[model samples]
Target chain A: MSERVKVTIDGISVEVEQGTTILNAARLIGGEIVPPAMCYYSKLEGSGGKCRTCLVKVSKGSEKDPRPMPKLVASCRTTVMEGMEVQNITSPEVKEARKGVVELLLINHPLDCPVCDQAGECHLQDLSYEHGSAATRYEFDRRSFERRDIGDKIQLHMTRCILCYRCVYVADQITDRREHGVLGRGDAAEISTYIEKAIENDFSGNVIDVCPVGALTDRTFRFKNRVWFTKPVDAHCNCDKCSGKVTLWYKGEDVIRVTARKDEYGEVESFICNDCRFEKKKTSDWVIEGPRKISKHSVISANHYEQLAPPPVIRKNPALKEANKEQFERVIRY
Target chain B: MESLSNRKKVLEQKPMTFGEKIYLPSIAKGLAITFKHIFKKRETIFYPEQERPVSENWRGLHSLKRDEQGRERCTACGLCALACPAEAITMTAAERKKGEEGLYREEKYAAVYEINMLRCIFCGLCEEACPKEAIYLDGPFLEADYLRKDFIFGKDKLVEEPLKS
Candidate 1:
């Protein structure tokens, strides 16, 4: 086992592995400092520093060095040093920097949360809720692009993309052959399939699991039902390429959507194949275990199970009836 | 005693003429007035078949409006449901997929929009609160139905016919 390094995040000290990133070190303390790392995936190798929302202020260096870094460093990429002091959750400067990063990501993003299939389980939505400003300072027309089909199963809405490149990394690492990659530059950059070839790889559906936003979504489950209304139950299927442990989003008795089951830290342990994600949607196809413990921020659970108040009964007014009768008697001399 | 003396005396000396006593002239005068109205334009309209012109500002049954591009304008934001004082409106929103741009005006469209006509009071608040101008109260009066369930207007009944390009 490697030697443990002690790190102080927001005055809460914790001991983590020697090569652990500051984001993981802060997570060791749990609730003290939660740096929102949009582009980081624990399962993928070298998976962060793309979205700068995880920037933190380092006050003090390790035992070997006495001076701290001059500027804010990305916690996802920066390693924890011995006795290093980091501030992510508490520092106003770090918060402001994260807000700026989130603002930049949202510049060209379409704010259509109500229609987005990823709204209930979206990482960007949660991060934006925690660290984003309500109003935007940008005054120019938002850049828009025509929606593209990445493969037979995946529909890509380039307008809502934040360009975190998690899908590209997942495809590169997990799949046997890479059929799709990001093309273009800057504001025009997008994930595309080469020569319009359909992504027929077995592990192509795992890209949907890695997407932090609605840029890449499942075409079959698109707009069928909101995620919150459907109860996510832990399910499994018999497949060769994957373990088939997936979450089936059930709307009543019918399974409406399927996704890889994420851990408590919001990371998928094993990437499931396309057959498990798409083909085996039937409730009969997989064994359903139990209901998914929906987080408080989930849009599905927000108002899903609450009992609607019964419609109020309309009552007839006795006084109004008597007044009407008196008026009738006065109108006709009866 | 002085106030009692100032009270007006009840007159009892008047006698009616023969024609007035029998009341034939007064009855004939009433008949003449009734007969005169028959020759003039009729005020009452024939039932069902011949309808009267409704006022321009008449608030009647609700109808979901369509944009000029023959697409549904409602994004299903639930603002109309919130604005409904009678709690008559309910809807489920869905994301508009590709090749469906010709059907929905926005990315978010109502998959199932229903308004309980039995519960609606035709207050026009929903129409006024609509930001997209997708709902209006310009439809004719809701027809009477035998079953209560028939009073519930779904998207099929509320949505306007798509404008032909």
Candidate 2:
């Protein structure tokens, strides 16, 4: 239990525990408002305010005498002060600024939404709907970069990078096994490997989640299906022993995708190792296409499969038939 | 004879016709040529959105090589920097110590290798110059920025994982 703080966001009054961020408190009194958090990992300690996506407006500041708090702040980093009022970052100017930032990111972006696996569920796409311009202003040619195979497990599209240090920051801060880091500066600065090494962490797949866009995607799920068609059903992960809640993406009878479900425990509290999160590969019942057949033995074509049966059991003499063996043995023994 | 040739040009040039004087037909021909080029297969690869295909010998974004055991193969012999014509490459070599056997496959390695992106013309000189095929320029050519400092690509960007068979 902690001290309670009362705050109003868009005329909705709510009381929340102290030390909770504006993002957490807003969740208490549900609203349609959404905060943008870049370079802020809920799991990484002291990892907020890097990209400043979670900006909010505080109308009344102090407990005694309240004035409007700073119109802008990194909500993921800022804690709830007593009697403070938050706007939930819905200002028109804020929208324009965020749009500008996203535009800058898209300037060099390959915009391969059709081919990318994370198109629909991507945070970058979500933000664009709420905070982006209609058209881009970059008249010049964009920066083109080929696919970089940083690790065997992960493929990095350098052109898709927004210069957010979340991947490397989380890698160094939380993973303790840093296989990635930012290289170069400004537009040239990108997420890459240390001397072309494979990212061999047990939890490397989380990079796919931390990435706001499809810059990082599971090599296993490449070009499988569009993300929009699947349904995210909340479930528990059965990887090892960790009971991290996971969302199973359902398309028809199949589970196409699996991801770490966000929870009340926060990103840090929910400790899911790399091996546990590999459940993303867990697929469900498939809807068979074309002619389906059941065969008992070997198949014919080049696409044939063979099924083998168990060998016959060995037999041994059971008790020498009957009592006739006993009588014969008695004579020999005597 | 040169004076007679120069004077002979004026004799044939008599009067300008209506279509020739208007210059409309010639302008239309020029416009058609421009339109043909617009629809034609452009040699320009839109860049950031579309990358140009790399020739087999084309040097691109540098990537340090790895051995079969997943160890770096750079001996850091300063050969690449020496061969660079633009002198864009700079390196600081260090001798391998005892326990770093798994870290670096080779004995000598670059402590620091940087290429000034602004100065580099992608001539592939540095790559051709290297005794060991450590530095390559195959891809991920970055976008142009408003600032000069952003173009300085460091070792972190240059490093890449080994190609899968």
DockQ of 1: 0.18
Query: How well does model 2 score by local distance difference test?
Result: 0.63
Best TM-score goes to which candidate?
1
Per-model TM-score versus the true fold: 0.73, 0.51
lDDT of candidate 1 over A17-103, digit per residue (tens): 899999988777776367877898888887898899889999888778959899999999999999999887778999999889988
Model 2 clash count equals 15
| Model 2 misplaced regions, further than 4 Å | A69-71, A231-238, A250-256, A262-334, B1-165
DockQ of 2: 0.01
**DockQ for all models, in order?**
0.18, 0.01
In terms of docking quality, model 1 is incorrect
| Chain A only: TM-score per candidate | 0.88, 0.72
Per residue, candidate 2 scores C-alpha lDDT tens digits across B1-165 of 567556556457679899899999999999999999987887877777886677687656666666676666666554455456677776655656789997676545666768888778888876675655666777766667888877777777776664466
lDDT of 1 at A313: 32
